[model samples]
Structures are given as structure tokens and as C-alpha cells.
Target: MPDLPDISNIPYLPSPARDMNWRDLNRFKSSDRGSDFYKTCLDYSQVLWRQRLPARAILCLDRAWGADLTGDEPILESWPLPYQALVYILQNAPTGVFLGNPRIHFQHYADRLGEPRLEQRKWRSWACWALSCKARPDFQSDPDHDVEEPSLEKIAQKLDQYGHIEETKLWKSILQAID
Candidate 1:
């Protein structure tokens, strides 16, 4: 695992209300308060990504997405920023930097998370195609999948619908990278 990115420049922490050391973070990992644990990890992951430490960010995302041992309780369903960030990394990051197949990791988490709504499904397929630079598999195909030109406009519109102004700003920043 990589070192935690420097987030001192960031103005705010997301949840749990206090600074937590590794020990404190670990304590909640196994606790029944899974939502708290998940949010902390997800918030930290966003910080890491904003700091341009994607490798470390991925670790935090892994923890956040897997925080709940029992799959029945879905904590992140309402939070789409993390999923968008994951797709950004998947499409942009080099595969060699990570030990195992990043796509497999993504697929596993996506399966666990289950199929998203139509808008998210389009982004997922588009991201997958962007990563491979090849035709998407039939199973992942979408009517909006324009092979010659993939636009983030639709995804941005979807984010707008969610009404998370901060996340919308973050999504715009992420789009800047691709543009």
C-alpha cells in the first residue's frame, strides 16, 4: 500500500467528527456501525483522489465499499461520487501500478453493488470502453455508446440531477482531465 496522501490543504473532514489515527480507523472496520466506517473511508478516499494519489485512494475506496461484511445493507447506494471517481481512475490509471487486475477488482465491486440506474450504467460501460480502447462487450453495450466520441455531458447532467453541488464541481474537475 502507498503512503496516505497529504490532505492538510483540504479544509474539511467528511464524517465521524474528529481526527482518527489508524487504530481508530481499524476499530470501526469490524464494528456494527458499518455506515460510519464506510463514510470515513469514502471521505478519505476522496481526499486522496483530490490530492492526486490515486493508488492510495483506491485502497481507501476498497475499504469503504467493503466496510459492510453483510451485503444486505447498502450504505453507498445514495453516494455516487465515489463510484464516479472509481470509473475515472479505472479509465485513467495504468494497470501495471497495481498488483492484480484492476478491472477484476472493479467488476467484483460493481457486482456486489449491483446494477445501477440507467444513467450510471451508461457511464460504467463508457468508462470500460475508454479503459480498453476497444469495443465494449455486448453485455455492457448501450445505445448512447458512441465509439468515435464519448461525451461526459450526459454523466454531468446525471450528476446535476443528484443536486450535490460539491460532487458536481468535483465531476467537472474530473472531466477537465479527460478534456
Candidate 2:
């Protein structure tokens, strides 16, 4: 059998927070408990694109989105800034963009977390489409277009479908990513 490529070999940029001005880092550190801190983290995550960091960018973006959904703070600012930041990162990342084929990454993480097959399949599909769309030209030009606006009905349905399981956390994070 051919040996599978090691996922760990993928290169990621170091966290920009390490190199940021102490004031900025202090803001992030202080805001960590605030809802807006996650969005700030997302903003910092944008630095990865300019620095050619892919894996780390996605990981941080995911973390930021996770914090956003946990009622960290209302995304008070318009989506354009964060969206553009993400687009820029996706475009420049060394992994050829699209965050490493969302289907594969999502499934790999899901399996590692011991998620059920059905839930894993659902998330994989959702994540793949979300990540793939990030590479579209329209995504960059029209920051709002790629976002999958979740209606109350959709959110409620998701809550109903996966809320009881630990996967709910993952689903919530996915919803944030899609937003």
C-alpha cells in the first residue's frame, strides 16, 4: 500500500500575536474574555494570509469563529473587513487555497474526535462546500455573497438535529464558518 502523506508535514505560520506590538497583544489578551476578542482574533488571523500561512490561519479563524458563536460578542462591525481578510488569506496561503479540501480536513478531525459516521458525513459536506467557495472570485469581490445566511428555521433545524450530541459544538462552529 502506498503510504499516506503525513498531515503534520503541512506548514503553518507562527501566530502573529507573538510579533504584534505589546499594546495590540494586550488588547487581545484583555479581550479574550470579551465577546469581541474572537473577532479581534479573526482580524489577527488575517495577518496569516499576507505572511503566507495557511494551516495556522484556518485553525485560528476556526477558533475565532468558535468564540464568536459562544456569544463572545456581536460581530458589531460589518462583515466586509473580516471577510476580505479571510479571502486574502485564502488566496495567498501556501496550500493552494481553500483550506486543504475541507472534506478531507473535516473528516480527519472528525474521525480523530471519534464522531459518528452520519454526523461526520454531514459536516464534511458542509465544510467542503464552504471552503471551496472561498476560492471563487466572487468571494473576494463580493464579501457578503459567499456567506450562507442562516435563517431562524435553519438554525433551529440544526439545533434539533445535532444539539443532543457533543457534535453540537462542532456544528455550531461550522455554522459560524458558514456565516
Candidate 3:
């Protein structure tokens, strides 16, 4: 048999399905929700891993958790709760979305998303991890700019690249909800 492609590196799978208990769901609903936001943040982190966006995926995860070490305000402030959760998990997340320069990644997320209160140690740790990933001179930056501000067209394009008919339909549904 032909050598199988390494499947281990793929990230961001199992798209998010809006299925959480009322309590878990309510956390993102309130402004003073506290750690609940972090929980939701982690959940989205898992989703990014399944989706295969990896680096950008982790950026989404981190943005959700409120790390935003970077200075970008509009991306952070304008982020909806779901998107924020997605970004937060993306930040410190391992397993998928590996990127270089955790500090730069954190700063990039901050630049994309407005700054928020974050645990200093956790944020720094993630930054370190990101930097380690960046140390590899061979790592090329992601070509997809739309990952930051994903539009229907971008979603459709990505779906066409990696998704099946059902997945494409599901992405359309997600786009409708976001719109």
C-alpha cells in the first residue's frame, strides 16, 4: 500500500454544534460571567482543533479566553461571544493550531481582538509555546487572511477546499446564524 499521509497534524475538526447545558450556555450570555467564559473558551478551542485551521484556530481560541496580549482592539471588542470563545481556546491550545511566537501570536490576537483581563502566567506560558513553534525557520505564515474576519465567501471557499457536501451545507447554516 502507498504510504499513508500523516493524519496526526490535521487540526480543527468536528465543527461546533450549539449543544451545551443551560448553565454552560448562559455563561457567555452575561457580561460578568467570570470563569464560565474560560470554560466556553476551551470548548471552542476543541472545535478549532477539529477544523484544521491550527495556528489561526488557536488565535481564535485565545481571543475567546480574554488573553489578547496583542494591541488590536476592533477585532477583540467587536468579536461576538461565540467568536471570542473560539479565539481564547486557540491561543494556548496544544494538539492543533501550532504556531510560532506565542508572544507574537498573543500580540496578534490582541491586535485582532481588543484587550481583556487574562491570567498572567497562563498567557505567558502560551506565549512561550507559540514562540517555540516560531523558532522553526521553516514555518510559513498561513496564507488565509480571511481567518480573522471570515465572511460567507471565505467560509464557502474553505468548505470547498476541505469539506464534503454535508459539511458545506453545515457551513452555510453557520454563516446564516452569524449573519
Q: Quick one: best TM-score, which candidate?
A: 2
lDDT of each: 0.47, 0.42, 0.40
Rank list by lDDT: 1, 2, 3
- lDDT string, candidate 3, 1-179, tens digits: 54433333222223346643335434455455344354455455554454444565555454344532232333323332233223233333444335544444543452344223433323332332333333332434344533343334544555455333343454344333431
Over 49-123, each residue of candidate 2 has an lDDT whose tens digit, in order, gives 444456556655544433423222235233311333434454455544345543334334433443233443333
Candidate 1's residue-wise lDDT over 123-171, tens digit each? 4433333332221121243334233335556546655663334444665
Each prediction's TM-score against the native? 0.39, 0.42, 0.34
Runs of candidate 2 exceeding 4 Å displacement: 1-33, 68-72, 80-88, 91-102, 110-130, 133-179
Candidate with better lDDT, 2 vs 3: 2
Using lDDT as the yardstick, the better of models 1 and 3 is: 1
Clashes of each: 0, 2, 44
Task: Evaluate model 2: give its lDDT.
Answer: 0.42
